[model samples]
Target: MKANVWHGKNKLQVDNVPDPTILNPRDAILKITSTAICGSDLHLLDGYVPTMEKGDILGHEFMGEVVELGSAVTNLKIGDRVVVPFTISCGHCLSCEEKLYSLCENSNPNAWMAEKMWGHSPAGIFGYSHLTGGYAGGQAEYVRVPYADVGCFKVPNDMSDDQVLFLSDILPTGWMAAENCSIEPGDVVAIWGCGPVGLFAIQSAFVQGAERVIAIDRFPERLRMAKKLRAETLNYEEVSVLEALKQLTGGRGPDACIDAVGMEAHGVGMVGAYDTIKQAVRMESDRPIALREAMMACRNGGTVSVPGVYGGLIDKVPFGSVMNRSLTIKTGQTHVQRYMQPLLERIQKGEIDTTCIITHHLPLDEAPHGYDLFKNKQDECIKVVLKP
Candidate 1:
């Protein structure tokens, strides 16, 4: 099998690796058909996560055909097409029953990590680091499916992989981000980072009845996408984000704000991993730059949702700036399974089309190229899907 590995800082390479085999009773094997590169992958590429090794497999979002199943796996059978959630979860956990799948006890059960929250704390993720349950990634010809019954969601035979690929991460992330906002009809939402997550956050906000969504990012291409969605796009390079945010909401900041840009923010120039994030806090710059801005831009008594990943300790939080505002802050990794089925139904009904975010489709071996394009934001590349 071939895969893209993160050799070091700003480096990626395609390499041949061993194929995966069924390892657990709940596991399944998938002949990967489509997989996506996400903003999260960039974090690993830049060494933001500690456990990513020299040859970590590098994809998470994917929809593929099941090739085999473990003895205990019953929900999914061979030949079924499914969209896999980036988070590994067990449906029988307390959290899973409550629909808080991200905190599923069987997977993580009590673990704070995404994989464990879903199922088998030992059930590693596809392409994340060892610390993240180091399950092999799907950025290859074949991937081993762990906790099959609790992980992959069976897609309708009529649906296209491209249309539902994001269900694995970003689309549901957007829905989770929106849910964090607690927005009411006619509410205003401001999203930082126009990347796919933020873009979906914008659309999802609209779907959730946000009357206006203001998108913030430095990229012209992303801003253009925001414009296409009728979201008011603001280039952070052009104006003071705080001032602009204030202006957009008629002197009141947006009712809700979401930070889709996580640890690898725009300004710090890929400042290493979660452990090194504390260094960012000491600087004058915002730790989670987007998160802080979103908090600062949130209306008094409103909410600020951070679907973006944030780690490391902070020295400065701009809390003083947002103080006296009685703001509510909501954040965490997306409870992907919670939204998967509902969003899948929406996709089946044509209420949302997330495929527009996918710009490059390449063979599994081209994973490095896809990363370069996505990381550099070049050729207007937003999402890249790898076919194995």
Candidate 2:
């Protein structure tokens, strides 16, 4: 099988790799039918992550068919079409029982982290690096799914791949982001970063009953998507986001703020989107922009939710702003399993077309092309799925 391998900073290689077989009684082998690149993958691609040994497979978001299942894997069967959650977890762990699958204690020991927790380090990641669980990912022809019974969800046969694929990651992550905001029916929410996750957060906000959603980003296509979805958009290029938001909100700010940009936010410090902050905390920062914006725009005591991924830290956050505003901060990766059934129901009801975000599709052998387009934001690409 050929997989997208992260060789180094700004370097990706399509390499032939070995196929996977069931390694545990709870595991299954999946034939990756469709896979997409995520922003977190960029961290590894740009060398922002550590211990990325050469030839590490480089993808996490995907859906596939079960080719083989271990004897103990009772919830799934061979020939079942399923979407694999990015987090590899044992179903019975304390965290897993609580639906915090990302924090599962028995998560793949051989996958990413041998000595850390989900909120810390590269504990368990797919094909990106060795610091993560060192697990080969779905960018290839075959992947070994650890904790298969709990990790893979069967995709409805009538649904398209794009329809159910995001249930693997973004849909749930966006839900996590929106839920963090504690949105009320009449609340207005502001989101920074128009990436797929950010877009999902915007949609999720509406689903959660936010009356107004203000999506902030510099990208034209993404901003347009926000408008089409009936949300207000801040270009961050045309006018001052905070000032404009404050003016629009009657000087109070949004009711809830979400930072989907994470550490990748551009033009920090409000000096215009071009002025980079002196230093950035290299971890999840729905804070830098959304937190600050929310403090200034949210109606005093609004909530701030962060579903963006972050790691290895530095720099001090403006804790005072958040404290003075009495802002609530919610942050985490999606506990996808818990939200899957509900989200699937929504999809079945024609609520949101999650697959509409897919801007490109390529053969699994062209995994490199998908990565290039998605990494550079080229081709107006928001998401690119590789098909086997």
Candidate 3:
């Protein structure tokens, strides 16, 4: 089987790898039909996330036909079309029982690796690094999905793969980010970054009853997409973001601020330069420019919602500002299983269209090109889906 394999920093290749077979009684083999390159994947490609071995498979958002099912998996059958959530969960665990599937204790085989880094471990994610779980991703022609009864969501026969595919990641991530904001009707929400996650965050904010959403980014194409959803956009390069957001909100600041741009955020003055230098030297693991800006621009006693991916240590976080203002912060890897069925119902009801962000579709073999295009923001690429 041909799949996207990670080599090292800024390197990915399509290689012929052995096909996956059922390794657990709860596992199901998926003949992958559609998969997406997520923003988090770019962190791995750029050497931001640690413990990624050479030739590791590199994808997580995917959907396909169930080709074979293990004896213990009774919820699905062969030939059933299904979308697999990125987070691997055992439904019987304490975390899963609370609907926090992303923190399921039983799934991360490499939990100790993560514990050394963050003092705790998260759920195993498909195609993420060894720190999360050394599990192979779904960027291949096929993949083995563990805990199938709890993680796989079957889609309706009439929907196209494009319409349902993002349920595996970004769509739910965006929705969760918005839901964390706890928006009251007519509230003003501000979001940083206009990438796929940010775009969906904008849509989800409106869906959750936010009266106005302000989107911030430097890319015209991304800002244009946000505008199409009626979000007022700001090109961070054109104005002082803090002041601009202040003025836009009548000097009160936005009610809630969403940082959808993760560790690779481009910063402006000396602070950004410091982050770049430290990141290059391995002194810091993430860039927190958007997070800092969001905290600085959020209304006092308001919420700060983070859907961005951050792997490790950050410096100069404004804890003073947070304490002084009494701001509430909520962030996490999305519990995709919790949102999968409801968001799918939204898609089925035509309440949301997830395919609006797709800008490129290529074969599974062209994954290298897809990664380059997505990382470089070339050719106006917002999202890329590979057909295997």
Per lDDT, the best of the predicted structures is 3
Ranked candidates (lDDT, high to low): 3, 1, 2
Candidate RMSDs in order = 3.6, 5.0, 3.6
Instruction: Tell me the tens digit of each residue's lDDT in model 1 across 1-388.
Output: 7767678757888888888898889998898889899888887777656556777777888888999899998777789998898877767767677777665555532233433222234323567776556667888778887778878888887778898889999999988898888889989999888899998898889988899999988889899998998899888888889998888778988999888887666333322443343343222343336766777778889988888775344334778766688888887667787788999888777777788888899987778888889999999998898887
List residue ranges in candidate 3 displaced over 4 A: 266-288
Q: For residue 119, what is the lDDT in candidate 3?
A: 70
Give all TM-scores, in the order shown: 0.90, 0.90, 0.95
Candidate 3 differs from the real structure by a C-alpha RMSD in angstroms, to one decimal, of 3.6
Better of 1 and 3 by lDDT: 3
Model 3, C-alpha of 209: deviation from truth (Å): 0.5
What lDDT does each candidate get? 0.78, 0.76, 0.90
RMSD of 1: 3.6
